[model samples]
Structures are given as structure tokens and as C-alpha cells.
Target: MEPPPPPPRWFQRLDRRLRLSPLGVAWTSGREMELMHRAMGFAALGFLTLVPVLVLVAAAQPSSGHGFARWLGQAIGVTHESQLQVERLFGVPNTALQRTTAFGLAALAVFGLTFGSAVQTGYEKVWDLPTARWHTMWRHVVFLALLVGALLGFVNTPAPSGDVTGPLTVVVLDLIGTFLFFWIAQHILLGGRVRWIALLPGAVATTLGLLGLRGFSQLVFSPLIASSAVTYGPFGTVLVVQSWLVGVGFVVYGGALVGRLAHEGRVFRRLKDQDET
Candidate 1:
């Protein structure tokens, strides 16, 4: 077989720089990019299941009041103007809505579970463990419950009005909530394979990454949403949301990678000491 071709000069330099930096070490060692791609695939699946549920719920409500849109805006901590845009985007006629049924809910649950399962598999791969199946259903159920709680917390907490404090409070709450969720998720999804302390770094990283993305969305997605609304109408909302999900997938997986690397480093040190003795 022919030997592989050499990497490009730019890539070689970039790789070397990554090797030198601490973050780069984790990124490379943890196979962060590859994991991110896998995560995006599953996250997309979750988004597919999730969006329909949101749409159905929104459509079932009276569109005249924009009640669903307003709820969603509160859930994500967006401003009033953004809330109106969301209302315009998601507000579907009641006549077109499908009734929520047991079968539909079951299917959504299965699809939504796949994303968490995928993340669990990714962490298992990182830790060099066999695939775990025991208690898998229960774990997914717990994850779903946690997700619902987080959403409820977000939507129920009113954003302070008419001052910078409101936005700051929103950001702080989002950060804290995300941190707690990711931290808990790391523990539950991984099935207690690693200590909680080992998971903190990645949880923190994921929280910060999410916060950064939220800020980026505020600056970038608002205009896109406005333009898309004018151009593609309601479908544009779907496009924007899917795009956001892709970013979220990367952050979620990347954080897992970071945590895995931390756990591995500790294990490596312990092994090395044993060898020396």
C-alpha cells in the first residue's frame, strides 16, 4: 500500500501550534472535532424530534395572541422584539395542527433519546470502555426530565424589564443553568464511570461555549431572522433553528471531549506512578 500523503504546510504549522497549547492538547488528544461531527449528527436527530413537538404545541394554541411565541422567547431569554419575530415564525394556524397522541409522543421520545445515547457512546469511546446498555432507558428518562425542568425554569423566570440588568441577569441565569445541566448530564450519561470532579472542566467549558454562542446569536441571528422572515417566510425559522442546533452539537460534544481528557490525564498519572513503583 502507498504511504499517506504529507499534510499541507498550513496544516502542519497549525498542528504544531495545537500540540503546544494546553487547549490544543485536549482538542487533539480527545479527538474533539471527530466527536463534534458525530454529535452534530445526533443533535440534528434530536432537533428533528424536538421541533415538531414545539410546532405542534404552538399550533394548538390560539395564534392571535402569539402565546406560544412569547413563551418560547421567555424560554430562551430573547428580547420582546425577538419574541415577536419568533411568534411570526412559529405561529401556525390551528386548522393545520395535528393532535398530540400517544404514538407521536412515543416516537418523539425515542428520537430524542438517541442524542443522549450518542453522547454517552462518545464518552464511552473516549474512556476506552465497552458500550453500556444496562439502565440505558432509565438514564434517558432522567435526561428528558432534566431537560424539561431546565426549559420550565427558563420560561417561568421573568426577564427584568427596561434596564441592562435584565440582559445581564438573563446571561447569568443561562450560564448557571447550562453549567448545572451539563454537569449533571455528564454524570448521568456516563453512568458514574468517572468522578464528578473529573467532569467539571468539560461542564464549565460547555457552559462558557453555550454562553458565547448565545451572545453570538444575539448579534448575528437577529438580522438573519429578520431577513429570512421577509424572504423565506416561516420556513426560514426552521433553517435558522437547525443552524443553531449544529453549533450547539459542537459545543456539547467538545465539552465532553475536554472532560474525557481530564479523566484520562488523571488515570495516566496513576498508572505511571504504579509503573515506577
Candidate 2:
């Protein structure tokens, strides 16, 4: 009997489906996970840098919430009376949740942009490719950074009158921006020529991840909220540092997973074809 040809490299291991064509699959299957890791890492890193800047911003205007307040008044065309009412409800950096949320939100975007670049590089590695030049990869990141920054601004901003309009606007804008960012990032990292329709999977995955993480955080960290406030003390600092490390690790693994799945799906169908032949 004639010997069968050796299996293709993309199908070298029939059982190891996860290791097949990891680069190709990662562009689709694992992109959202990579983005999640990037976002979390950036937010954590941002917190490290932003706390100090916020302290400085706070010190500069200790007497009033003027910096943020003015930003609000101008952004949404609200009257001073409406702004003051919000200020009273949310208070200033001295002791307001808004202050923490503001710094947190800003850090999230800044650091997310930083870490996202690294995640894309990891994606490139799984594709057995050299890292893309900054020129090639940067415009996408810059666009995402601006888009996310604007969303964060809206999320952190206090409502003009505690009405639904402002918060609703922020939510709608954030969701739309997030979906667009996903589409663009995938295009850049995967070098895929795709339309926005191709991004539906990414959008759905991201929304699911966000919701899942929200629930996980609420369940896992809820106890800490009441027991002791977590801060940047040594222990909390270690935890934050570890989370970023873990996030980076996940990005790499996610890239590989994506590549493998894409490779496998293709190879499996090819193998079935050969058997039929």
C-alpha cells in the first residue's frame, strides 16, 4: 500500500487542537481577552502614576473643584447652578468618590493604551512574525487612546442635575467607542482587511468579558470594600503589581490560543477533505 503523506505542520498533532495555527485564531478568538488584559494593566499602571498627578491637581485647587467643574460646565453647556448642584452632591478631591473614580478612569485609559501596544506585539510573536514598527501599529493605538479618553471623561463627569441624560449619554458613547476600538485594534494586530461587520464577534466578546469581570470583581472584592479600604500600601501595591503581571501573561497566552484555534479549524477541515479524497 502507498504510504500517506506526512501531516502538514499546521496539523502535526491531531489532538493538540489548541496549538494549531495559534496566530490566525488569536486574531479573532483571543483578541478580546488580549484587550481585557491590556485595559486592566493600563488601569493599574495609571493608578500608580495618576495618584500623584491627582494629588498635585488637588493641591493646586484645594479651595474649589474648579478644574473639573469648569470642564463639566463647558463640555455639556450646563449652567453654573446646575454644576454647583453636582459639585455639592459629588464633592471635591478632598473626600469625594468622584475624585477617586476620576483618577481611576483616567488611569484606565492611559495605561490601557500603554499595555495595549505590548499585547499587539505579543500577538505578532504568535504569528511567527517580527514586531510591527511603531509607525505601523501606533496610529491605531493613538486613535483608541483618544476614543477611550473621551469616554472616560464622560463616565467620570458628574451629571448636570443627577438626571439620566448625562449618564445615559456616557454609557451610549462608551459602548459605541468600545466596539469601534475593538474593530480597529483587531484590524491593526491581525493585519486583516475586514469591514466593521467583521468586528461583531469582538464586540460581543468584549461586552461579555466586561460584564463577567464586573460580576467577578463584585463577588471577589466585595468583602474587601467593607473590611478595609484597599490602598497603595505594600500589600495592596503587591496585589496591583501582580494583577498587571498576570494580565500581561494572559495577553501572551491569549494570542497563542487565538492562533492555535484558527489554525486547527482550518487544518481539521483540510484533513477531512484529504480523508474523503
Candidate 3:
């Protein structure tokens, strides 16, 4: 019989390094980096499509006009200058705004379908599962509803006034809310196949990573936004938003990989038990 083909050089190196650390074992065993690479394209596409829809929705709410802008600025680590540029670009007469909203909403509905489908495809790939058929419309609707609700909650929360504790409090609440949102997304997108216990690690990791990204953005991307604004005008905000979404896509894929690894480990244990019996 022919000898088994030798392992890839990269895998061999990975294995050698992975053996030195338990966490590395879990991470490499799931091949999360590989999965992240595959899922990122779809995730980025979903974000690109979804962002315009969010802008439209925020524009439609006149009473909370500045609220959305402020939230967007905070989310992307941009300054008020960037937010002002956004408002100026989108500003128009009421009649024009109404027409724009109508057209934008229609376009968003179509794009939302694409976004949902892309997210489902990513989940299916990570879990090594067949495509899900049931509750397609329901799932998409629920997903959008959850997202809108989360945004509203974040924007409506009162901003910190004076106390040092206030900012920290907001951050903690935001982290918890983000964790819950990610957890629900995993459960819903995976068709409820993954258990809650197995999903927690990935959800937490993703949430913390996202929170870290938010902090990192201020130090890194803020200057980029400022320069782009000077050179490119209002469209600079769009560039920053796109870059932020790409980071989000990578985080989403990483979280899914973590959850998948935990689920597979559990399955392997059960099979080993059965074989021993």
C-alpha cells in the first residue's frame, strides 16, 4: 500500500506550535483561521449592503436625527466633524427627503435579502451542515428586528454626564448587550443546532474582540478619517465605515469558528464514549 501523503508544511509547523499551548490546540483544531478567510467575503458583502439601509432608517427618523449620527460616530471612532459632514451630505428639503426615503427603503429591502442569505451561508459552512430551509422569512425578519432594537437601545441610552463611573458603566452595558446580540445571532443563524453552552465561548470572544476593536479604532482610524475628510470630503466617512465593516466581518467569522470548535469537541467526546462501550 502507498504511504499516506505527508501533511502540508504549514500544518506541520502549526501542529508543532499548537502542541505547546492548550488554547492553541483548541484554536488550531477547529482551523478557525481558514474558516475566517472563507467567511469574511460573505460577511463583508452583508455589511456593505446593510449599511446603506441603516443610514436610510436613521435619516427617516427626524425626531432622532442627530441621535443616529452620534451613535455612528461613536461606533466608528470618528469625531463630530465626520458626523457633521454626513448630515450635510444627506440633508435635503422635506419633499426630497421623503422621496429619497421611499426609494432607499425599497432598495434596502432587496439588499437586506442578500445580506441575510450571505450570513446564513457563512453559518452553514462553519457548522458543516446542510442548508436550512424552514423559517427563512421568519429568521430574516427576526434578525433585522433584533438589530434595529439593539441600535435603538444604544442610541436612546443617556450619555455620560460628569462622573468617571458613567463612561465605564456605559461600556459595560454595551459589552453585555453586544454579547447577547452575538449569542442570539449564532443560535438563529445556525438553525438552533448549536447548544447554548458551546456557543458562549465564541460569543464572548467575539464581543470582547469587537469592544477591543472599538477602542483600537480611536487610536488608529481616527487620523485616517480626519485626513480623508480633508482630502476626499464627505465621502471620507464612507471609506471609514467600509473599513469598520470589514473588521466586523472578520470578527463575526472568528466568533463562528470558536463556537464550531466547541461544538465539535463535544461531539467527538460523545463518539469516543460510544466506541469505548
Best by TM-score: 3
Residue-level lDDT tens digits of model 2 in 1-277 = 9999988887756536654444444555455445565546555554454333444444445654555434433332334444443343223456434345665758655665565565565455444456666566565456455544544454355545577787677556655765565556655665553334443454445544443443553444333322322343334423533443354345334534443454556668889999999
Give lDDT for model 3.
Answer: 0.70
**Relative to the unseen true structure, what is the Cα RMSD of model 1?**
4.8
lDDT of 3 by residue, 87-110 (tens): 565442334345665667677776
Candidate 2, residue 158: lDDT: 52
Please rank every candidate by TM-score, starting with the best: 3, 1, 2
Poorest 10 consecutive residues by lDDT, candidate 3? 89-98
TM-score to true structure, per model: 0.76, 0.46, 0.77
Candidate scoring better on TM-score of 1 and 3: 3
Candidate 1, residue 207: Cα displacement in angstroms equals: 0.5
